[model samples]
Target: MTQEILRAEGLRKSFPGVQALDGVDLTLRPGEVHVLLGENGAGKSTLIKMLSGAHHPDEGRVLLDGQPVDIRDARTAQRLGIATIYQEFNLVPQLTVAENLALGRPPRRFGFVDTRAMRRQAAELLARVGVDVDPATPIAGLGIARMQMVEIAKALALNARILIMDEPTAVLTTGEVDRLFAIVRQLRDAGVAVVFITHHLEEIAEIGDRVTVLRDGRSVAEVAADTPQNELIRLMVGRPIDQQFPRRPAEVGEALLTVRGLSRRGAFDDVSFEVRAGEVVGVAGLVGAGRTEVARAVFGADRYDSGQVSVRGETLARADVHAAMRAGLGLVPEDRKGQGLVLGDDVAANLGLVTLRRATRAGFVDLRAQRRAAAKVAEQLAIRMTGLDQEVRTLSGGNQQKVVIGKWLVAEAGVLILDEPTRGIDVGAKVEIYQLINALTDSGRAVLMISSDLPEILGMSDRILVMARGRLVGELPAAQATQDAVMELAVTDVEASRVQ
Candidate 1:
């Protein structure tokens, strides 16, 4: 019989406003890859945080190799061989890769730190992840994908026996994801139990050996990875999600947005497209394909060398975010915490961000007006919290995303640009978002959606545009678009396509 490496029983946690987890239980065996699944408000993160010692459970017990242990803090958990890689990276940008890897336990000799020894250790860890990088390089100079690799190395260096990864592939390309899977397999072969948490269903089948479904802070079911896909999805969603994406009838109206000869130096170039009112135009491509960059340029977040963005035939100025807003455009960025929300604020406060002026009276803040407006959308989105005053940081990943989308919903713009809007969200939340998108178009608003998930793009888009490197390569009608076609365009090899 395989030995159980880690176990949590009757886990319970609560805050002033919400009971994040309630009587959750999980168990893992050595050399096994266990997947955790739930919808946005299902309490997956809260449970992981408790298991990793980021938060103490109000009630429950944790067992490591049949021994009960008291883990009050992250350091204690690390000492007990549990390493957690959160979705939001915790690396210091100013530090060198080697120094960051050996921050807490650097080798010391003769009252001096051993720099050569640190580099050797960092390099070996990087090699394990199939990443080749100079240990002397500063982390800030590295891209998001490379930084993720460094995080994996740091986790391994700690001799972690039970590793927890949250949304590990949210920022990786296909090739990088494959490389990561190989390392995960190696770890499992060496008897390291892994608790994998992801929004991608395909990954559960690809890397997971067993699956545990969580619903409203409880373990609903546990099964082998080979369990039928529809059955597993039903367990997590609490309903038969026969299809991940549901198509809506499209009525492409008058062109609401037109981008002509859009070019930005070293980012995107000569991109042109038209989005009609009551239509969704999907931008599909692999990572670094300039999909998000295009949305940024259109929304005036980045400067463009040459291009004309028009709403209802009126030209928009470059690098003018305020002007873009005035021209009836709203952008839901990919990086929610970094660019989407004020993490330290409450849900009502974040919801009032876009239209704060409207909620004020004669330069005096109107508390009632802000609450009334925020409460309406909060209810519409079904955001679960004690009240609107609850901190956004305490909410689940899906709830955080809802707040981000709620801001735009209240904006009521003529044009909406969403970048990876459904990423890291659970199946039920994704379905809600899809319905919301349909409502947006039904109300005569145009949507420019940038997503890496092919099913989302093909099912929701009235038309699709694919980009590779920095150039737009192909456009397909939603009826004709398929997973294979989008992949072809995203990974196409054209020498001139790479961005500088």
Candidate 2:
């Protein structure tokens, strides 16, 4: 029988305006992956923080091997064989891999720092996590996947018995995700208890041993890993999501946005596609396949060495974002927090950012007009918030995404380019976003969506375009597209350039 390594009972934590966690319970046994499922603000982060000693639960007891203990800080948690790998890594980028691994506890000889010993230990830890890199290599040079491996190595170096991975695969490619899962399974077999958190419902059956669902800051359900997907969705959002993708039939009018021979040297090359009015065009590819690069180039966020981007038969100037915006184009960037939304501002402020000039009257701002526009978009997108004045940073992931999309709606953009539109958001929010997409296309706007989710691409897209090695390799109508067909074009080379 497996032993329960960590247990939390009736965990309750409260911030000034929010009761982040209300009577949450969790039990993690050695040699099993316990998936923690919840929408953003459903208290998953709060529970994890409490478990990792970043926060103290108001009313709860945490047990280690059935013995009650006080976890006052991160240091204390680490000492007690618990470590957390957050979505955003905790590694110092300026430092070398070895230095980062031995951050708090460096090897010492005769009261002097022992660099050689530290490097040796770091090398061993890196190998254990299946990371192939020099110990002396700077952390800044490593990619997201490698950085994650380093984090796991650091945790293992600290002798962690209970590992908490919070959205570990959120930013990874398909291949990278598979490798990470292998490492996770290896750790589980070695008797490490892992608390995994993710927004992707498909990942549960792939790696999880058991599942726990949280709703409105409470533990709503716990089930076996093999539970049906619909039941899990029901427990999570308090309703059954019968249709995951709410796609309407494409109207397929004249091309609203056309890209011809679009090329960004070293990023993407000879990428060409057309998004018709009332149509949804999806760009699908593995990471580093230049899907995002193509989107950015078309939107004028990045310079394209060679290309013609024409909207309604008018050619746009190269690398000019203002021109793109003025030509009825808007891009919801992949990095929503960094490029999409101004997190420090309130909902009204962010919603009005793209349309501020229109809301201005002869050197004076119209607050009423801004608020009205914000209110209209907020209602259209069903953005859940305390008020229009609520800071964007404090909102949930789904609501934050809505605000980003809502900005374009307020801008009256005719062409919308969305990169990773449904990434890192919950199922309920995904459905809502899909409904919004359908609404947009139904209203005769063109949508060019770049997504990693296969089902999303197949369901919402009128036609799917696949990229490989920075080139458009294939295209398929939605009726003819399958996961296998898309994956083939995404990864492998084809003799012919396009798939009609």
Highest-lDDT candidate: 2
Q: What is the lDDT of candidate 2?
A: 0.89
Cα displacement (angstroms), candidate 1, residue 245, comes to 0.6
- lDDT tens digits, residue span 1-500, model 2: 67788889999988757788899999999999999998877988889888889999899899999999999999999989999988658999899999999998999999988999999999999887667899999999775557878887887776679999988877676777888899889889998999999988889999999999999899998999889899999899998888988798767788999999998778888878889999999999887788887888888888989879999999999999899999999999877886898999999999999988877889898999889989999998989888899999888888999999999999999999999898778888888999999889989999999987788899899899999889888999998999999998887763354452
lDDT of each: 0.87, 0.89
The number of clashing residue pairs in each candidate reads 0, 0
- Candidate 1 minimal-lDDT segment of 10 residues: 491-500
Scored by TM-score, the top model is 1
Q: Give the TM-score of candidate 1.
A: 0.94
RMSD of each: 2.4, 3.0
Q: What is the lDDT of candidate 1?
A: 0.87
* Superposed Cα deviation of residue 496, candidate 1 (Å): 5.9
**Could you give candidate 1's per-residue lDDT for residues 292-375 as a string of tens digits?**
888999999999999899989999999898888888899999888889999999999998888886667888888787788789
Q: What is the lDDT, from 0 to 100, of the residue 61 in candidate 1? A: 94
Which ten contiguous residues of candidate 2 have the minimum total lDDT?
A: 491-500
